[model samples]
Target: MTKEIEIEAKNIVTKDEFVHLCSSFQLKKQDFHVQHNHYFDTAHFDLKEKQSALRIREKQHKFVLTLKQPHEVGKLETHQSIDKQTMDHTLATGIIPNGDVANQLRELGVTTNTFTLLGTLTTSRAEIDYKGGTLVFDESSYLSIVDYELEYEGEEEEKVETTFGALLKEFNIPKRDTDNKIARFFKAKAEQS
Candidate 1:
């Protein structure tokens, strides 16, 4: 298990803006890869109510369970690696494995067993190093909805904001409020229901 503080700035973009950014950044088709995020929550969204989220991310045949919670500077992320069998069992039984992530949820008053598979969101993503941060371009699809986003993840909040802002200005992309993938997925799920 590993823990980290995730500080990032992000904005939603239009399809045309997404393409334009790709062109400006010289991101080729091969630069992109696909990842699947399987979100989980209790029936009443207990975790969501606490401003926390849990997910098992599958990338390149590997799975990592992560729990994100509110923190002073940014979201605190706890990650634990799991195998395919574990992933399947959790999805089928709504039981999380014994690990730091589960422990963190328990600390947040969220029982591990209460979680059920909410849904999955798949994204075609590309990343590049820019201004001492990782700049990400994502086109994600979930529940018949597709969206584009640009994110800058870095250690320093001020740098992340300034760098991300400059990039948007450079490309003439408008700055719009953007929810993280899990939140967006939850919103889409609610709309569908």
Candidate 2:
């Protein structure tokens, strides 16, 4: 399993800032996720893209698993996750198994019409729990976005998450980087001007 250090910022930022910041920093885009993404006719999974990733989920001796995409990995660059978060760092955990996740998909307009399809599609995934930090870069989706989850571990299991627009500060290019969607978007935006 591969590993990554999730970066965190001090406060929330806007989409406009994300676009501007990326170009300002001269960050390049990379096709990092394509390697593991399993493309399906209608749905797929992507977490397996990193040759099995090692996640340092918040608190509780870090568990091991081949990073798995809990849902269909689409070309559109979209994803969803649940993190169990709390104020303390040592007790953090990420995965939360519950039925509410399906409802979340339906609320997001990602549901299907057939039961077979519904069973085939995945709406929720294992959670990521990190204390004093959260995941910033997602190698999925086509938007300039980042996510940070706070996890609290206990019998009750509480959680809180924060997602924001992202600004690619740098890209290693062909080696390790985003697919360059934000760059293309900004380029088109500049050309239209």
TM-score of each model, paired residue for residue: 0.97, 0.20
Per-candidate clashes, comma-separated: 0, 23
Among these predicted structures, which one has the highest lDDT? 1
TM-score between candidate 1 and the true structure:
0.97
lDDT accuracy of residue 127 in candidate 1: 94
lDDT accuracy of residue 45 in candidate 1:
87
In model 1, what are the clashing residue pairs, if there are any? Answer: none
> Model 1, range 134-154, lDDT digits (tens) per residue?
999999999999999999999
Q: How many angstroms is residue 78 displaced in model 1 relative to the true structure, after the best TM-score fit?
A: 0.1
Q: How accurate is candidate 1 locally (lDDT)?
A: 0.91
Candidate 2, residues 1-193, lDDT tens digits: the string is 2322223232223445434434453434631112211111112312223211112222232222222222332221122232333212212232222334334334444343111111111111122333433322222221233321111122111221222222122321111222222233333434656
The number of the candidate with the highest TM-score is 1
- Can you give the lDDT of residue 28 in candidate 1? 97
